[model samples]
Target: MPRYLSILTFAAALFCGACQNSHSDSKNQSSPEAGVKPAFVAQRGTPVLDGSGSDDLWEASDWLPINQIWAGTLPKPDDFSGRYKLAWDENNLYILAETTDDVLLDVHPQALEHFWDDDCLVVFLDEDASGGTHEFSYNAFAYHIALDGSVADVAPDSSFRYFNDHCLTRRIARDNVNTWEIAVRIFDGKQYKDEGDNVPMLLKKGKKMGFALAYCDNDHSAERESLVGNVPLPNTQNKQQWLNADVFGTLELR
Candidate 1:
């Protein structure tokens, strides 16, 4: 695993812009609420990674609505509505998120910079369920999935870290509505030493892992309008509490 020195440096660089904003003014600030318990059904078969959610696994999975606002006021029904389904196999975890938005935007094209400024979905996971670390641990992983289908990580080096040797597949669609599908290997509580390694841990039934989901909404503005998350992210006015694994909720493989 990488040292905390590098992780802190990367976090500082990534969140420097947030320091300028005074969070004391709570006019538009959002807060996380209690999260819902959605059982992760085991995949019956391998679902295609395309953006279309037409597979049998998705049909059987539960679509949990994402309505909590973590950093802005409650959004109107016409503004946005999102729901996601979860399924896991022995080697990988699958996610199919369908969102309804009036406008689809992706201003930030770069992989590692300013992804939150555009519409994006973020998934935080602690594979080992160890929650004492304030910094990113080997077990914790944060994935930023941009509207353009770019995946970026902020821990273990920050700038576009690849999982499963970039075997992850993601697709995005923009029409009257926007939707996305993603599949990535489940990481063990170990770091990939080099390009030659392909180590992964299987998620079994009844095993618990720390998990959280979030989405960023930017409606063609200079800044994002909201940072909606599934779990509470307290003390975010001063720091980026989302980076800490302790803030995430528990996910049991069922």
Candidate 2:
């Protein structure tokens, strides 16, 4: 079986909480019935793609926490914690994630096969905001940032066999803190062909996109112990939300 099908099959056994909010874009502005949908402020200048969090541009951005766990109750701050900030220029969207984990486990070298099983950061992006069942379309994008500073695009089916070279990622781990910086080219939804043939998507004020953030934690184990995300995921009753784009929160360009 294919990787996506295998994941979907596995997700069928997991359980999720009841959804609280109706699907609406404006509800994302404030606290919505579903949950708080954080917004990413646009930056006038691009920040350097270094893993260091010393950029002045990130100083003005808001840090959204990744708190919702897939199965167990929320963990304490001392055990594990993660927060991310976002900024976008004309060409690309920049993301910075600062995470604190007592144990950093990264054993997967091939991103397409086992990155999710390791300690990593995953971002889901629905570029067109269509909110359709994107099983076959290349409308959504999922970028996996491994703890080893390797990056891979996991969305749009084709990425299962191919790796994305356009997206840039960097990471720095010291003590219990891990900092990651990523730059993903914004592509025009109309002309997107594959992960390789990406055209820069021009984002303007008030433009909305389907967005979600997640963290995978593995403590020297064969599989991840917890999968935490910012938004409520689908098929949580039986499976993880790594493949579902429709459950993502709204992200408005500012």
Best by TM-score: 2
Predicted structure 1: lDDT? 0.66
Candidate 1 clash pair list: 30-70, 30-71, 30-72
lDDT of each: 0.66, 0.68
Cα RMSD to the true fold for all candidates: 12.6, 10.5
Local accuracy of candidate 2 as per-residue lDDT tens digits, 115-192: 777887877778877665554455666666776656666445544533355467788888889888888776655577
| CA displacement after TM-score superposition, residue 76 of candidate 2 (Å) | 3.2
Worst 10 residues of 2 by lDDT: 14-23
Task: Give the TM-score of each candidate.
Answer: 0.73, 0.76
lDDT, candidate 1, 1-254, per-residue tens: 46998899889977764544433332232322323332233443468887778888788876766666677656676577777877777766777887776676788686566777788888777777776553444567777777656676645443455343433656665654666777756666566443446567766777677777788877878877777766555554325677667777777767
Scored against the true structure, residue 34 in model 2 reaches a CA lDDT of: 46
* Candidate 1's TM-score: 0.73
